[model samples]
Target: MTAGHVPVAVVGGGQAGLSVSWYLGRAGVEHVVLEAQTPVHAWADTRWDNFTLVTPNWHCRLPGYAYDGEDPDGFMTRDEVVQWLAGWLQTFTPPLRNHTRVSTLRPLAAGGFELTLATATGEEVLTCEHAVVATGGYPIPVLPAFAASLDGSITQIHSEQYRNADQLPEGAVLVVGTGQSGAQIAEDLHLEGRQVHLAVGSAPRVARFYRGRDCMTWLADMGLYDKAAPEYPGGKAAIEKTNHYVTGRDGGRDIDLRRFAVEGMRLYGTLSDGKDARLTFEPSLRHALDKADAVYNSILSDIDAFIEREGLGRSVPPATRYSTVWEPDAEVTELDLAAEGITSIVWAIGYRPDYRWIEASAFDGGGRPMQNRGVTEVEGLKFVGLPWMHTWGSGRFLGVDRDARYLADNIIDAHQRKSALESSALRASAHHHLAVAR
Candidate 1:
């Protein structure tokens, strides 16, 4: 079946796609947003019950919908975030097709592209002059090959599947990967007085507050978000680094792994191999902890420099420092899950992009679409919402609007050009016929 055609079609009705739709609407561009589920699906479904934004509420800017809440400094819980997203959707009321999944997309032989959408009723084909893919960067969770070797008695789940400590079976829990989700989930389990074992990765940690200001606010003020990925110290590779672990829960605070260790949470190094109930770990726990602290202090030092350079030493409070409260005396390289009473494992190793449905040559070896600020070499193809698309905030709610606006302008320009060319050809044909009659 054919669902007709459109000038523009946006895939994925998440924040990214909705932002683009808002811009297209403002410009009077006719477009339809195709979403596999509800627009607020991710916030509604994947997140844990207690999940809150690590960034401040003030950063929740989606197009014209800048956060106007009373608590700009506070974080929005999962439900609040969903409401905020839905609120934006209601404001514009853009054309949206819910429960419509774009199963495959390929460039047409001519100027447009063909999309195969799967819905509850049946399959439908739709063609569009331009397609904006805003399906986000991370789509699939990553798990170690050894995860399958674990005993069947233990319940294993990805971080996206984790809800709260009560959801897991009664007993000790082992949380792997110290990225943002891993670290925060470990803390959540620890808070419930569960015997939590954390397998720490090299992911860095950051202070929640600095100089009486939220760390994110200070960083923004310091122009960190304005810096492009390539301009970072490590260049483009820095864009791929795992986000620093911090939390805005309970009115915001630092996620200090060392503090958790001091409080009796068993910390292990990176998990290496697993078989049945036995798991082996590397002896880099101390190094990983130290490296995390070093990065944390380095950020503080940068803030201090920014304060000194701005000559706001008096206005801002004195610089605070983090101290190493606890460290592993020696590496505990192995643990038997059965003996340790480990009943569940939460794998927080992160996610990778899946562009397999998009049969286009715009992808790199790693499956990331190649684009410059969301505009690709493929004429009518574009992308949005990938991390570091142009700046540090590109994929985030902080700067997605800017990227969307740019793409909207590009689409408008293309339409104008096509109309002008067609008008010129029509006039030329008319003149030729008149000359032949004379």
Candidate 2:
């Protein structure tokens, strides 16, 4: 095994990790970024081929690597995003160790952390005074046990593995989870001339464009994106929820299960329970549909209120509505995917962060990393690019830059404090030695 040390070790290499590195360079801190794959891991491998950013080009904030192009309002494709990140990495030529997966991160007896990494060459140990867990919010997929209970004939794949409809087996698809991924992937399948069953939960959505302005621009103008975690009333649950459901297909359109339903995609309630070849849904299907409508209405209400406050006289078209439901009061709950001729299942149930590598003190009872906007109780340890770490947009491309800068400054301050104490101790030791000699 090889061993080395750095003042700070960033445990990711996506936009967040690279962002932190940018500020660290300005601060002149000796740091290295450890990545399990190539740079921009998510953009490169996790998303579908036609995926595009929900946020516009102008919102691609990466500190010194801000987006510079003619189409600021345009959305970038997945490949475009990867290329941009690759080019940005060149500016700093960051000390990045690619394909180095961190197996464990524990506090060292001598101070700081011992990061055990598994690399191509062999096992490697990296000692760092300060550790930054910028390893993004979605590396691990959250698959439900029901997926295992499905028939052997059914192919189940998480949203991360889904590329296109043609890539899967021929037949109807059951898309579980109505978050951004589930919604978009369902639409992709439906447009590809395949029957799709989308299981939708209480997910909020907003129009992609209104009043000739992007919804994101309106949100940004209202300073809603700047809201901190404390500003959220329901603590962690509220903070973790993101208000994103827009689409980049069809020249940047709004996507929701309701719209998919109108487009002929069958919608189901949340996946509640399942047995072999059998799926059960919560009887709250109507409630779930109403909840979605309410969330959409709330978004529109906020936008209208903002427009009124700003005295902008642009008239908005009559609000679009789904105004429909399927089996509103059905007594049946169990769904047989095999009987329904469902061939594949796409699990888009969001991500559960894996912090097994980190020590116990670094996390809360709920497995969430215990940190105050990336600065933890562990003196030399910190975090960045986590949802609700500081703001509503934390963990997103536009907001990661701010969080990264904050953590970088925080790490630098810790380094300075350590250096100061060491200098004082050395001086005192020298004086004591001279006095003893005399």
Candidate 3:
């Protein structure tokens, strides 16, 4: 069967895909973006109603689109973010086929790509020289298997499914994972008069306002966000997990587990297991905090080194580390969720991309999409927002655009090269014909 052809087929309509599309459009490339949901569906659908961007407005650097709002330093709320993305779509008017979910993306034996999509109308097939999967930072929410072992009486929700406190049933909330979303949700529930228990791990935190500048500002000044994964003191391992983590509430304040502990929120080590109406936890809270502190200090040290080397001597706030002051092992290990009246469990375990649709040899053994930056093993196949796609900020709002730009440039160069080859071949044929006539 003949498939509709385009130079490029962009899968996913979120910021990543859209950003890539924007670049392609600018370069006059023929491409179609396939969006499963509306643009920015992640923020519009999955995120909580009260969610706000952890990064400040200034850091939301969409290519050719800057945040032109009254508060550059202020964080944008969920709706505002959606609106911005929707507006970006409107401005560029990228060729977006909405409600089109790609069922399969595989390299054809002949050449190029074969795409099968279930769109609003019906099933459709497409062929493109290049394929860009901007599907998501990760495919599905990372949920712990132990969640199912809990008593059926307790309502458990992945951070992705959670809406707001109003929707949750009455009782204490056991928010799992001390990462960004987990910490923010726990703090929100705690401050909103809900007894919150955070299952802490070695998730780091940085003060929103560090020294005389914002944390992001300092990082930017020091080129931390732009640094490639290999440049980190922790090396590529530092970016193996979710590299971005910051709280947006309290007007862009730091919401670490230790701070949550001091503020009356119960902090426990990792939720090791659940069995027979009992929950087991790792006795590593202090170790976790130390690890978290280490990351923060590492970053700050980098900034300090930058300041010293550049001769930009700027006085900064003194370092103030949060002390847990509580023994992790001694803290309540086994807790009966039902007996403790824990009505809700917010699992903020994190996310992993679902590239099952892709049949190309572009993913690694661990299922992570493998590529040299955005360029994959399969020629003309690329990924835009995977963790460490190119840099620490690769999966971030400010970084996706850069990755998109690179992918677009890469595709365009290939196209030009193809065109050049064809032109040279045609010229050779013409000269041969003339020679034969003579």
CA lDDT, every model vs. true structure:
0.92, 0.81, 0.80
Angstrom error of the Cα, residue 387, model 1: value is: 0.7
Task: For residue 240, give model 3's deviation from the true position in Å.
Answer: 1.5
Q: Give the residue spans of candidate 1 off by over 4 A.
A: 431-438
User: Mind giving the per-residue lDDT tens digits that candidate 1 earns over 222-268?
Assistant: 88887877787678666778899999899999999989999989999
* Overall local distance difference test of candidate 3: 0.80
Q: Report the C-alpha lDDT of model 3 over 291-388, residue by residue, as the tens digit.
A: 77777766677666776787666466554444454444466677777787788789998877678878888777778877777887887788887767
Q: Which stretches of candidate 3 lie over 4 Å from their true place?
A: 310-329, 427-438
Backbone clashes for every candidate come to: 0, 0, 1
The lowest-lDDT stretch of 10 consecutive residues in candidate 1 is 229-238
Which pairs of residues have clashing backbones in candidate 3?
A: 139-353
Instruction: Rank candidates by TM-score, best first.
Output: 1, 3, 2
1-438: candidate 2 lDDT, tens digit per residue: 989988899998888888889888888889999999978877878889888888889888787888897788989988889888877877877888899999999998888899999999899998998888878755679888667766888888999999998889998999988778877888888888899987876666667887678888888999878978888657767666645566877569877565566667777777888767889887666677677667666777777788888778556554444444443435346788877889899998888878877874877776788788888888788888887788888888878989998888888787788899999999999999999999
Of the two candidates 2 and 3, the one with more favorable TM-score, higher being better, is 3
Off by over 4 Å in 2: 233-237, 314-332, 421-438
Model 1, residue 215: what's the lDDT? 90
lDDT of 2: 0.81
